[model samples]
Target: MTGKTALVTGGSRGIGRAISLRLARDGVRVAVHYGRDDQAAKQTVADIEALGGEAFAIKADLEEADSADRLWQAFDAEASGLDILVNNAAIIAPGPFAEQTQEQLARLFAVNVQAPFLLVQQGLSRLREGGRIINISSGVTRIAWPNDVAYSMTKGALNTMTLALAKELGPRGITVNSVAPGIIETDMNPWLADPVAADAAAAYSVFGRVGRPADVADVVAFVASEDARWMTGQYVDATGGSQL
Candidate 1:
């Protein structure tokens, strides 16, 4: 992956941050895309630099309608072409199916599904031949999550997108796939801080522990590498065998 260029959306924090560092460590010049926190973005870039890696921070509000176009435009200014595109930015609305509002549903789909779809659409020209496109999906798409139906639905769409794109882009050698992670230790799951709740979550995994960001990041790293060139349109589970 040395000398290759990759963009990781939501790369400023959590699982995305881990993926950014891991890719940088593998000699990929990273464009760390963040939605809001510039400080976090800058820090991620600095950390990569400290590791003797090349990285830069870019911003794109995924909620906005034109964000995808703006994001690719920003990427255009940074590098000549892209070897990898990781659509890791996503937002979730956790609530009962009956309680989900139209507004919340729209935004959830906008950020989680539509944004990635449009990003790929706008990025196809910049995406190099034989490049990789990895969508960060979730295990919720497979498991039942009645309380967060909208969130699960969005990821389901992402998984479908991966399948369709893989077939469409195969002629160009651009592999498209999705990485679905289970319960992970990140800001998104703060209840894990509670010992009882943590144990409950841990029990879902045969590994008997909540997953770390690095765990999922490592799977993504492999998927992004040439080692996974033969793999595409598949949901690479980084779920620690959770909810099995």
Candidate 2:
């Protein structure tokens, strides 16, 4: 990955941050994208640089079409074509569907689904032949997580994109797939901070401990690397058996 350039969204914190560092550590130059959290984003770039890796942070609220357009434009102008795209920007709402407003559902889809697709569409032209596209999905898409219907629905759409785009881009020598992570120790999982939710999550996984951001990032990094070139249009579960 020494000459490769990766674009990662929501790379300010949690799994997004983890993925950015992992790719950079492997010698890939990274363009880290964040909606806000400029400090966190820069900190990621700093960490990469500290490790002798090259990285730059880009801010874009990917939920908007215009923001998406500007993001790719800036990327095209600055970077030497894309080699990997880690579509990791997503939001979650753990409450019941009855409590989920239409706004919440739409917002989830916009970030988790539409944003990735638009980025992929833009990247199709930018990505080099045989490039990688890794989308970060949730293990909840496979398990029956009560009251997470809206979030799961958004991820389900991502799964479809993985399958469809893999086939669509196969002719072009690009591999498109998704990495579905289970409950992880990220701020996104407020449940991890709760004793009850934390205990339940630990018990749910085959591994005694709940997952960490690095756990998911590790798999994403591999999928994006040349080692996983033969794999595409598949849902790779890095969930510590949480789907079981």
Predicted structure with the largest lDDT when compared to the true one: 1
Evaluated at residue 4, the lDDT of candidate 2 is 94
User: Candidate 2, after superposition: displacement of residue 62 in Å?
Assistant: 1.9
Best prediction by TM-score: 1
lDDT per residue as tens, model 1, 1-244: 9999999999989999999999999999999999999999999999999999999888999999999888888888989999999999988789778889999999999999999999999899999999999999999988897988999999999999999999999999999999999999999888889999999999999999999999999999999999999999999888999887
Computed on alpha carbons, the lDDT of every model, listed in order, comes to 0.94, 0.89
Each candidate's number of clashing pairs is 0, 0
For model 1, name the residue pairs that clash. none
lDDT of 2 by residue, 1-244 (tens): 8989999998879999999999999999999999988899889999999999999888899778687898988787779699999999998877976798988888888888889888888778889999999988888889987789999988889999999999999988899999999888988877678888788889978887899999999999899988998999999999999747
- The deviation in Å at residue 7 for candidate 1 is 0.6
Q: What are the models' TM-scores?
A: 0.99, 0.97
